[model samples]
Target: MSRFTDFFVRNKKKLLIGIGGFASVIMIGFVVFLLNRERILKYAVAKAIQKVENKYPAKLKIGNARFLDLNTVLVTDIALLPNDRPKLMQIDTVEATVSFRSLFLGRMVFKQFDMAQGAITAFKQDSVDNFSFLYKKQAAGETVDSTAKKTSNYGTLLNRLIETAFENVPDGVNFRNLAVLFKNDGRTINMNLPTMLVEDGEINARMTITTEALTNTMYVKGVIDPDNYLLAAKFYGDNQSKSIEVPYIQQKFGATMRFDTLSLSITNKVYKNNQLTISGESSAYGLVLNHPKIADENVTVQNGAMKYVLTLGDHYYALEPESEVRINKAIFYPEATYETRPKRKIGIKINSPDIPANDLFASLPPGLFDTFQGVQATGTFKYRMNFFVDMAQVDSLKFDSDLDASPDFNITQFGPVDLRKLNQEFTHTVYEKDKVVRTFQVGPSNPNFTPYNQIPNHLKYAILTAEDPRFLTHKGFHEGAFRHSLITNIKENSFVRGGSTVSMQLVKNAFLTRKKTITRKVEEALIVWIIENLRLTNKERMFEVYLNIIEWGPNVYGIREAARFYFSKEPSQLTLEESLFLASIVPKPKQYRTYFDAYGGLRAYPRYFFKLISGNMLKRGLISPSQAASVSTYVNLSGRAGSFIIPKPDTTHVQLMDTLQLAPIDLLDF
Candidate 1:
C-alpha cells in the first residue's frame, strides 16, 4: 500500500499537466467552432435544401442566405417551384433568431421570426395540383427503415403534432404582405394578409379575403402560450354590416356559411396513459348557414356557444360528457364517440336538463323551425337522446330519444299552424314543388272526405300493412322499423327506404311543407312526438285526417276521391285487391301510370309489392292465409284513371309470377 501511494504521488503532477493540456485543446476547438458557426449553419441549410429537392417533385431555391449574428439568420428571395406547374411558394425575405443552444443540439428553435412579401399559390387544373407532392408517398422500392418509424398511438400522435406546432410558433413575429391563393378548375379564391404581428404571446392580424361573391375584411386578435398549449382568439368582420363568409364551401359543397364574430379558446391539453384530452370553448354570433339539403331558406342562429372536452385514444375519438352547448338561452350537454377498431361504431348522446320552454322555442334556428318561430310557450322542458350505431351490425343500432315538458307547460300563442287544428275540421293543402297543387277539407265539411269508421276495413288494413303495420300499436315511432330501414339503407348505400309511421305521415302532410329537407324531416318527427305523447288528438282522428288528405292519383285527393276515380265506387265499397292497388301507388302517386302496362295490367314491380304486403299482413294475422294467397295483383280501371292508361300488349305476367314465387315475404317498400 505504501509503494502504491508513493507511485501515485510521483505521477500526480504529470497527470495534472496532461489533464490540463487536454482541457486546453477542447476549449480551443470549441472557440474555433463558435468562430465558424455561421458558415456551418449555412452549410447545414444548403444540405437541407438539397435533401428536400431530391426527395420531392419540387425545387427549393435560396437566392441569398447569411447570418446576421451568432443566433440570427436572414434569407432573401426564397422560392419553391414544382415540376411542370406554377411556383408553389415565393418569399422576398425571411429573418429568424434561433436558440443557439438548440442549434448545438441539431434543432431549429426560433425565438423570433419575420417574413415579408411571401405568397403561396395552390392551383389545381384537371387532375394536376401544385402542392400534392408535399403529401405524396415515397417512390416505389425506396424503402423507409421500419425501425426508424415510431410506433405511436392516436394520443401520442396527436400530442406530438400539437407540441410540434406550438413549439415552432416563435415568441415574436412580423409577417407582412402575405397572400395565399387557391384556384381549382375555373374558380379562384385569394386571401391577403396585410400585416400580422405577434409580441409577448399576443397576436393581431388583418386579412382581406376575395371570392367570386364578395370581398370581406376580417380582424383577428389572439393570445397564445406555447409552453402551456393555450390559445384564445377572436375573429370578426371589419364592420357591423359585414360578415366573414367562409369561402370555397359555397363553390365546392354548395353550402354558404357566414358569421359576424367567432371566438375560440383552447384552455388545456393533456396526454397521459395513452389518452389525449383537450378542453376548449367556442362561441359564434350572428351565424347564418344556407344549404339546399339543410333547409329551403337560410338558417340563422343569433348566438351559440360550446364548451368542449375532447379525448382521443388508440381507436376512438370522443367528445366527453363534460361538454356543454348553448344556443341563445338554452343549454345542452352532448357526448359523442367515434371508434374505428374492433368495430367501427358511433355513439352520440345529448341532454338538455329542464330548460324554459320559451328558451327552447326561441333557441330554434330561423327557417329550420319556421312553424315554431312565433309560438310562445311557458314552463320548462327536458330532452334526452342516445344514438349508437355499429357499422358492422346496423340492425342492432340503438336510437332512443325523449322530450318531456312540465305538467304546467302550455303554449300561450300559436304560430303559423296550430297543433290543435288537426282535431277539428281544417283545410289541408297539398303542395307539389313548393306550389299549392290542391286544397281539401280534412273533415265532414268536404263532401269527399271519408270518416275513419266509414272507410272500408280492407282499405284501411291494406294501407296500414303496406305503409306502417304497427301504426295502431306503436307510438309515433317504430324502433324496429327504423332499425330495419337503417340496415337496408346501409346495405344499399342509398336512401331507398323511410321508416315513417302513420303518425309521422299525418304530421308531415298536415303541418309541414312538402320540401324534402333535413329540417322538414326533423320538424315532422318532433310534431309527431308531440301529438302522440301529449294525446293532443286520438289515433282515430289522426288516421281519419291522414286518409282524407293523402294524394292518391293525379289531382286526386283522399280515399273517397281515389275510390271513385279508380273503381267508380265509394271508399267503403273498395275491395281488398283495389285497396292494395291504391296503397301501392300512394308512394308514387305521380308515377302511378308507370305501375300499369299499356293494357292497364299491373306490372311485375307492383305485383311483387302486392305479394310482399299481403304476406306480411298474413304473418301478422291482419289477414288470413286464404286472403293472402287469393289476393290478386289485378285492378280494373273504370273511372278517369282508365283514360290515362293506353292499351297495349301485356308481357309482364311471366315475370310477375316468377317474382311472386321467388321473392322473400319480409321484403318492404317505402
Candidate 2:
C-alpha cells in the first residue's frame, strides 16, 4: 500500500500534464472544423445534388457556392435540367441564412432568404412532360391493397406538411424577377413577380399574370408570422376596374371566374393531442363567374365572405359548425365532416337565421336569378338543410331541406314572370334545346286548352301513377323518389333518372326554360317550393297547367291536342286504355311513335309500362281492380300519330291483367 501511494504521488504531475495536452488537442481540432465548416457544407450539398441526380432523371448544376457568414450561404447560377427536355428551373443567385442549431438537428430553418432572377418552367407536349422526374415513381409490380384497413393520422401529417412549408418561408426576404411559366397542348400561362419583399414580417409584392385572353397586374400585401403559421393577405388587381382572372379554369373546365379583390387571413393553426385546428377568414368583392352548367350568362356577386374553423384528426376532417358564410346582407352557418374510418361517411349541414326577404332577393347573383332580378318582397325567411351519406350504405343516405317564410312574407311586385299569372289566363311557351319551339295560351280562352274539371279522372290518375305517386300529398319534392334516384345515379355514376315530381314539372313548364342546367334545376325547385308553400296557385291549377303545357306529340301542346293527335277524342272522352297509353308516351313525347309497332299497336315496352301504371293505380285505390283488370296494352293510334307508324305485325298483345301481377311498379316509368 505504501509503495502504491508513493508511485501515484510521483506520477500525479505527469498524469495532469498528459490530460491537459489531450484536452488542448481536441479543442484545437474542433476550432479547425468550425473554421472549415463552409467547405463541409458545400461538400454535403454536392453529395445531395449527386444523390438527387442519380435517383431522378434530371441534372442539377451549381456554378459557385460559398458561405457569406457563420450561418449564411450564397449560391450563384443554379439550374436544374431534365434529360431531353427544357430547363426546369434556373436561378442567377440565392442567399439564405439557416439556423445552425436546427441544421445540427437535421432541420433547415431559414431565417432570411434572398433570390434574384429566377425562373421555373413546366412544359408538356403530347404525353411527355418536363417535370415528370420530380414525382416519385411507384415501384414496378407493386400492387395497392385498396381494402386494407389502414388509419392515417391526418392531423399529424397535415401539421407536419404545413410546418415544413412555413419553415422555409424566411422572416426576411428579397425576391426579384421570378417568373413561372406553364405550357401544355398549345396553351400557355405565365406569371411573373417583378418584386417581392418581406421586412419585419410584412410582405409586399407585385405580379403580372398573362394568359391567352387577358393580362392583369396584381398586388399582394400581407403580414406573416411564419413560425406561428399565421398570415393575413390582400390580393387585388391594379385597379378596381381590373379583375384578376383565375387561370386554367376557363380553358380546362369551360368556366370563367374573376375577382376584383380577395382578402384572406389565417388567424390560428394549432395541433394538440393529435388534433389540428385551423381558423381563417376569406372575403371577396366583385366576383364574377360564368359556366354553362351553372348559368347561361355571367353570374356576378358584389360581396361574399366566410369565417371558417377547420379541424382534422386521425381519420376525419371537419369544418366546425361555427363557420359562417356571408353574401351581401345574408348570413348562414355551415358544417361538414368527412370520415374515412369505421365506415366512410360524409355529412353536411347548413342553416340560416331569419333573413329579410328583400335582402335575400337582393343577394341573389345577378345573372343566375334573372327571373327574380327586379322582384321585390317583404318579411323574412329561414333555410336549413341536413345531408349525410355513407359510402358503404348509400341507400341509407339522408337529405332534408326546408325553407320557411314568416307569416307576413309576400312578394309586393313581380319580376320577369309573375308568379300570380298561373292563377289567371297566361301564355305558356315551350323550348327545345334553348330555341323557342311553340307558344300557346294556357287557359279556357284557348280552344284546345282543357280546364281541370274537363280532364278525365282516368288520364289524371294514370299520369299521377306513372310520373309522381305522392304528388297530391307531399310538397314539391318527393323525398323517397329522390332518395331512390340518388342511389341509382350514384351506383351508375351517371344521371340516368331525374326524380321530378309533378309540381316540379309544372314549375319548369310554367316559368323556367328546359335548358338542362344546374341553375335551371335549382330555380325550378325554388319556384316550385315558393308556389306550393305560398299557395300562389292551387294543386288543381298547377296540375292543370302541367297537363296543358307539357308536350304530348309532335307540336302537340295540350291535353285536348294530345287526345286528338293520338286517339282522335276529347281529353274528357278518353277511355282508361287510351289514358294509360297517353301516360306511357308522356316522357318521350317527341318519340311517341317509337312505342307503337308498324301496325299502330303498342310495343312490348309500352305494354310493360301500361301494366306497371295500372297496377300502381290499383294499389293506390285510384282505380278499381276491375278497371285495372279490364285495361289493355293495345292502342289504335287513330289520329296524326297513326300516320307515322309502320305496318309491322302486332307482336305485343300480352294481356294487361296477366302482366300486372308480373311487372313491378317503377316510379320513374315516365
Q: Number of clashes in every candidate structure?
A: 0, 1
1-670, model 1: which lDDT tens digit per residue?
A: 9998999899999989999999999898779868878766776667757666767777789888778876788989999998777999999999999776665654456788999999999998886788756644446334333245434356767777788678779989999999999998988889999999999999999998898887889999999999889999999998654688888788788999999999999999989888999999999999999999999999999999999999988887999999999988999999999998788999999998899988888889998998888888888989898988898888788887778889988788868878999889988888888898887777887888788899987778778877777777777988667767666677677876777888998888898887789999998887787678678898888889888888888888888889889889988888878888888887768777767886667888788778877777777677888888899878898888888876545557775764443332224433
Deviation of model 1 at 112, angstroms: 3.0
Go through the candidates in order and give the C-alpha RMSD of each one to the true structure: 6.5, 7.5
TM-score of 2: 0.81
- Summed over model 1, clashes come to 0
Candidate 1 CA-lDDT value:
0.83
lDDT (10s digit) by residue, model 2, range 1-670: 9998999899999989999999999888768758867766666567757765776677799898777877788889999998778999999998988766554443445688899999999998886778755533324333333354434776776777678667668779999999999999889989999999999999999999888888879999999998678989999988654788888897789999999999999888999999999999999999999999999889898999999999999888999998999988889999999998898899999999999998988888887878788889989989999989998998888988888899999889878878888898888878888889988787878999898999999899989888877778777887767767777677667876677899998888888877778888978887887788888888888898889899888788889999998878998889998998888778778877667666556777777888878888888788999998988878888888788875655545453443342232245434
Q: How accurate locally, in lDDT, is each candidate?
A: 0.83, 0.82
Runs of candidate 1 with Cα error greater than 4 angstroms are: 1-75, 79-87, 95-109, 123-161, 184-187, 269-279, 309-322, 337-346, 594-634, 647-670
